[model samples]
Target chain A: MWSTIGEAGEFGLIARVTAQFPGTGDVILGPGDDAAIVTAPDNRVVATMDLLVEDRHFRRAWSSPEDVGRKAVAQNFADIAAMGARPTALLVGFAAPPDLPLSWADGLTEGLRAECARAGGAVVGGDTVAAETITVAITALGDLGGRPPVRRDGARPGDLIAVTGPLGLSGAGYALLEAGVLGPDDARRLVGDSAGGADPGWAACLREHRRPGPPYAEGPRAVRLGARAMLDVSDGLVQDLGHIARASGVAVDLDSAALVPDPALVEAAALLEQLGAARRAPVEHMLFGGEDHALAAAFPPGTDLPPQWRRIGTAAAPGPEGAVVTVDGAPARAGGWDHFG
Target chain B: MWSTIGEAGEFGLIARVTAQFPGTGDVILGPGDDAAIVTAPDNRVVATMDLLVEDRHFRRAWSSPEDVGRKAVAQNFADIAAMGARPTALLVGFAAPPDLPLSWADGLTEGLRAECARAGGAVVGGDTVAAETITVAITALGDLGGRPPVRRDGARPGDLIAVTGPLGLSGAGYALLEAGVLGPDDARRLVGDSAGGADPGWAACLREHRRPGPPYAEGPRAVRLGARAMLDVSDGLVQDLGHIARASGVAVDLDSAALVPDPALVEAAALLEQLGAARRAPVEHMLFGGEDHALAAAFPPGTDLPPQWRRIGTAAAPGPEGAVVTVDGAPARAGGWDHFG
Candidate 1:
């Protein structure tokens, strides 16, 4: 029963949002000041920014405000994790229509706080303004914890390529959403039916589509274990591996057998089949789906990977055509989501 | 002729934009990586963010792509400066339609780089995405250099209130622009007429309206000289001072005679009069106009002000109504631009 943003006023809405996120951890100066002061401790700070635009990046019809907010924070924080840095703080710039409900704004703030908490960071500062469309721009700051950042250009020949979290689940979820098997109304109902364990696979994919749970801690762990190069699987695994390949002046060959689908994805495939979807191999989704947010890294050959890490590929000297990424010794097609494509 | 973003493709447009901003200064890792790494020599970083939406915060007809980019960086950096810090790096999140001209994006990047150089910072990282409207969200990170941040809550009774940059000029320029006496076409011509010094007053006002030159270095200087409290005059002199007064639990009394307008504003008034506009005191503009980005600070009583700083008022114990700011012994109205207002 909250009033709209126009009725609550900008300052009033800001106060309400700030109250929800009291300063925590190394934040010397939090919101309500000119700028937030964050303790970097190591004399270096890792920073990344991302912009999510309505309809282009997300649809209000499909995502609740909370889902939108969580996704915004998650993706940006994933970039920081990709650098093998522990996220410390975030600054959000949100713009939406004046007539939007204040409850929606509150939901968005709660979602942001929840995601930042999961990433071991806090929402230190932000700005909100009125605009015709909803736009969320987030800047995530991270602490390297006295470690050198794991850059994409540092991989060498004979490195082992690995992944720390699930891939292709988000892509499968997106496919289900796009096929209208689980519409917005059904998705909202499913969100409330936590105890109704019916169709767990469908629910898991839908949840992944709405809010990704990136393995944030594994990033710094990989760096600590001497990861030569690393990045997040935001664009598909093949596309992002191609980036590391190009940056490191090497070629990567991913083993198709090693790119195994998780149990949830296997269930999601069955659900899609029951829902009359065309029998496309779920392995295709595993290879090309975007927004997985899994940490992909290259470590020295014969290095012991942590239990959570799974070997998926190997890096080698480039072939005749400069740097390339292949699947089972064949050059893989570079297909991934591009904003302007 | 440059192709549109859709035709050029996202990666091509990004390459074009990134080429304009080469990394400089304390940037350990610049753009095109997973994230940018910046040195925070003092072990702390001052961070602030701002969002500018097309038509809501600015008009494409009025601001060139370059002006828009510069203004976006300038305003966010000014917030860091207001905290008594030297800006070190910037992260930009830009969202525009797919059909936006690639040349415009390149011009925006060039403008951002120029302004960041002025503020002694570099555009270390950024993200560009497709959206329905053009939106620029900039996050500025700053170094405090082992000095304490001059916060808005530190003002005390008997402190001298001062400003380090011109006030109301941007406001006066906005008035002229709104009245159509200085239309966008004329303003563009004025920008190009660098050597044509005729009507210097009109040209100055127009220039200030397009791009404000805030006293960035003076912020840390004020802190070194023991500024009691500080903030930027972004939301009008009276309104912003009121924020300081409320935060410090004190009252501020301004001498109206000391709130002097520059000669250009006086000339602008005459021009508006000749244009048959409603006759109003230009002082109102000085007290209420927004987006100036001038620094306002409170110093100890009887302190010798620096050459650039001008004392205009004194802080005192709060009046019966608690914290307040008055002009010429009259309580000033708290009227300023609010996004939702």
Candidate 2:
């Protein structure tokens, strides 16, 4: 095997990168063709795309290739799931430097394969090109199972808002990494035998940040349970909820107690505090942090919810203040992740 | 309006860029949500993705933002077309530096809109992020209209190889730009009016390079006409034909006469020669140059071809040489576009 992609060459590297990728199941035509065909059993395709740029979305110094690969797929699948669909296939567009290690590509492929397997999908096709930096672009396709898509504009006044998974864990993990409390893969590189012992909470936070596992099935389950509005909490719960508010022409209010920080995030907050780094309350991360990839939805009042989905907020008729997110019936600081900003 | 993306911010920029984009066609759910749903109609989705990186795939100094946008969509659409499918939706992932002008993004959006209109599709949804360089990733979803996908592994012995449109003009145009002849927009900036007078042939070549108009309809037509195997003539006709040859277990031999250079390419070749650049014949460009994105396919011998398709070669049962592309019954040079190589 060649050490570098430049050495392996395009065709050779492509063959190597895609050799053992699973092709059975939903894929009618996989890689090595002009295009890939995936079954759209409902005669509709729920598709979403995401881009992971090195240094912007991820840093190689912090994340392993596998982690980035998993993240790329996870982000896109979250979008598909948010639409109440089950993912079927992913088409990747990878651009990396020629001198990039072939091993990294292999690890990335493994991560993509593992994630696709986890989501009941396959990596059907991809294009590879040489560039100065690594850019992973993924397109995830899903099927809605003959149901009307749950759109963001469906949230009605008096609907209860619930989250399908933990919120702000990735952001907390990111805060830890930014302050040198690295993830398991590079924890030693950042802090050589840090002053504290190994912490499972910290590890969990790191894992969540590096390889988030969105509740893919819960999306369809929520739809079947008659949830109205749903979205992936990528740009913070407060900010993303604002999207539902605006789209549905309603005002959203979060219950402070329901938005309590997780134990892992509390520990992450404590670590940052001890490090004398910039600090914020654990709930602040939940409020304004991003990249959690958790699904948040608005369900009709009196709807029975699964134990896994935590009721966090409620939608109400918009007041004179128009559509926005508030806490405890009061306006909360409005902030969200914006790449350009 | 804000001048730079950084000034406009993510929300403002997204609103501005996507405000005027058309969305009433095959898209079931367009932007303003986590995912876009496109109608598949026949329970199958023909999907393809492609990436364009600044400086590698295009030069801003040569290609306008509009040109890059057109190229990005064209490449992915060609893949869908090659699969005998009609594109329905496109999801874009755009990453650029904060310093980029908002007007550039506007121009890019216009180009995306124009091309999507041409292909009978809509720009459904996209993810925008900040990066050090510009990268545009596009995923095109297509409907097959209840037809079986035309694959690259179906060419039988004695099948005639044909091309759906002109080839090598993009490569020739690339040669012109690389040698300072430049496209219409950048030509004045590069050559300083020293090239005697404006040339229509060179302009056509530049258009091919900057904004290749792949005869998309021809792809589904080929499939309907009973094409045995087909592929997009990206990375050169010879190199791409090898895909079908290898996949179908056939040797492909080109009719040198049938592979005549287009007049536009001949002019480009002459210009490149006069500039003392690395010289290549127009036929050489036809044989080895790439990025034309025209469709190439194998059909049963004596199958009547439409006027648009030119019979270029023949597929035969593999000899000792295994699967390969030969010219004039002799082994031809096997050079083509390779990103790493």
What pairs collide in candidate 1? Answer: none
TM-score, B chain alone, candidates in order: 0.93, 0.95
Q: State the weakest 10-residue window (summed lDDT) of model 1 chain A.
A: A187-196
Tens-place lDDT per residue, model 2, B1-341, is: 58998898887877876676657658777787888888889899998888888988888898898998888889889999998999888888999999999889888888898888788878888888899889999888899997778999999999999998779898888888777766554555654464435565667888899999989999889987899899898889888999999999999999999988888788778767767789898889998888998999999989999999999999999999999899988987887777888
DockQ of each: 0.82, 0.83
The per-candidate count of clashes, in order, stands at 0, 0
lDDT of 1 by residue, A25-122 (tens): 77999998789999999899999999988888888777888898888888988999999999999998989898998888888898898898898889
Per-model TM-score versus the true fold: 0.95, 0.95
Instruction: Report the number of the highest-DockQ candidate.
Output: 2
Candidate 1 scores an fnat of 0.90
Off by over 4 Å in 1: A183-197, A273-279, B183-200
Evaluated at residue A195, the lDDT of candidate 1 is 20
Best-fitting candidate, scored by lDDT: 2
Model 2 alpha-carbon drift over 4 Å, by segment = A183-196, B183-196
Whole-model lDDT per candidate: 0.85, 0.86
Q: Which 10-residue span in candidate 2 chain A carries the lowest summed lDDT?
A: A187-196
